[model samples]
Target: MARHIYVHNPFCARKCPYCDFYSVTDNFLCEEFYKAAIKETELIGSVITEDAGTNPLTDPDGKDTVYFGGGTPTVPDSRYICELLGAVRKAFNIASDAEITIEANPSSVTPEKLTEYRQAGFNRISLGVQSLDDEVLKTLGRLHDSKGAIEALKKISEAGFTNISSDLITGVPGETLDGIKRDIGTFKELGVKHISTYSLSIEEGTEFYRRYSGNIEDLVSPELERSMYHGTREYLQKLGYETYEISNSALPGYKSIHNSSYWNSCEYFAIGAGAHGFLNDLRYGHRDDVRAYIEEMNTVTYDTYKAFLEGNESFLKSLYVEERLTREDKMREVPFLRLRTTDGILLDEFKKVFGVEFEDVFADAVKTNLEKGLLERKERTLRLTRSGLDLANIVIEDFL
Candidate 1:
């Protein structure tokens, strides 16, 4: 099992209407909560290293990935960020080549901050440059405009950071195909190493959902959204970026190590308000309320938290409520996540992990999807075809 750490910064300058991630602005608590986060991370790191004993920090095979993700990791003061990174360094026997990533919003980062992040342990920066068009930026309620994004990209490169990834939002309301193409063109010119593009979804309780419920007519049509996905894939491929996952494109050897861990069913630790962690066959999330998390931290013992981590199976079942998955569910989920990558999943590997032959288990569902031209089997690996990529949810649901 791989050991990874994720530090979630729950502070944002302001929440985007479409965002449902745990975040707040009016009562920003970075000053009050950051130190507690560092302490939590120190405790978690000590546990992981203690479990490893004298061995290398990496699993026996030597693979470890650490990530700093957020509501704007750069929103807090640089010294606090450095202190948190320092804690990880002190508590864990980190591998020399450990991949350390920090997700930054364009508006929150400056040249000095990028330099400071580099001087600290972070080697990769994932910028949140949602869109390149001014109108789209306004509609999304992003704090930064296209110019700010461009400047940040330039600064990241200038600051001597070699691995840089950016986030792009597709199918935003009022966005045109040409506008998305322009954004891609801009990314190419900026020489970014990786790109993660996602189609906008309206989550319940978000402003987008509210407007959609009220019959808002400006959102992209389903057909147009599909077109955007296809167009973006083709354009990125032409620009020499490899499509590693459904929404991720990277230059050779620049894939996101931290994110790939989750897709590959590896375990990682999370720290901060609303932060989540998966380890020892368990998953756990901290309280979303910042005050609650801080107060609980003051009273909870590490052993109690360990016990809570052990209760993950029940917690996940309760959280998903009506949609509890079974053995057949594992059969579907294993392939569904694996097929998201271009490399796909090895049939033998799936069997090794799940204790059942892949074909013997889901032959009917596989055959149906293959006949529908949504799936393809190659060299003992089954994966989604180009058509399947667009209709992925529908195809994945067939097995469920």
Candidate 2:
């Protein structure tokens, strides 16, 4: 069995205006609550493994992917995060080549801490450097400027971390097409292995959403956003980066294994406050409240696990209230996610998973999209055209 694990760090030095992830900025609360949460997660994993007739304390096949994702995994005491990784190793079957990834904010990491992370079996680091322009960084309320981001990149490189990735946001307020191109050029110069460029969507309940909800004029225009995305994609491709996913580009053989697990609908275990896990087609998310999560573990019963799997949708809706997906959601999701890769989804695999022919499922919608020259069906695989990629959301929503 392929097992994956995720550790959530709900602590951050500060929250960006566009971020809606579960995080707390109060240092005192974070320092007090994170350790206990980590311990509880270890215990939960132990119990689950015992119940499933598997040994939690030993690696059988050595095939595991552990990911540290959050508001900022590196924001917590480096030692504490290291201990959590140690515990995961003790409690799960981890592969020798397991992909262990940790997410870091450029402002929150140090050269020494990064070196320590490397020693702690963390082979991958993802820096949240949303933009290379100081002005754009400020507009996004990011704590680190371009200089800081470059320094962080240099530190990771010097520490012998070759599998480093950076996050970039396009279409942010006050950003220009030239500025985005400059960011891409800088990334290429830095010799980073992977890049995940996301469009800035004003999520509801976020500070950006509240500030710009009624004022549409303050946001990046649709045409400009498309132009920025197109230019960025072309520029990155020229640098020998493959567009492996919608927002992710990677150097050859450096794609993120842990993130790919989610898109492939593979099983994984989650630990820490607000962390989520999927197993046996059932999903569960931990409580967001740090105190509640720590306490509930001691008292949590088997029924709690059942309730979690069944009730996850409601919790997800409350957290990401605006973008709720449905069962028929696969109509769009299947192609959208598959097209992100060079090897699009196999028709036989889709039939096995969904019990339907891929073409038959979206026959009408596919016909319309092809007529408009937005999609291509070749060699038993379906993919988006260059024009379709620019208007991805529009093409995707047709099946919805």
Which residue pairs overlap in candidate 1's backbone? none
Candidate 2 local accuracy as lDDT?
A: 0.76
- Candidate 1: tens digits of C-alpha lDDT, residues 1-400: 3457777888888999999998878445676688777767666654554553221322323456678887778888988888888787666666768888988988888888888988888999999998999999999999999999999999888998889898889988888878877887888788788999999998999988987866746778888899999998888888888998999999888888887776665556778886776555445566677887776666656665544554433322211112334556546766767778777766877777678888888788889999999989898888899999988888878766
Clashes of each: 0, 1
lDDT over C-alpha atoms for residue 160 of model 2: 86
TM-score of each: 0.91, 0.86
TM-score of 1: 0.91
Q: How does model 2 score by TM-score? A: 0.86
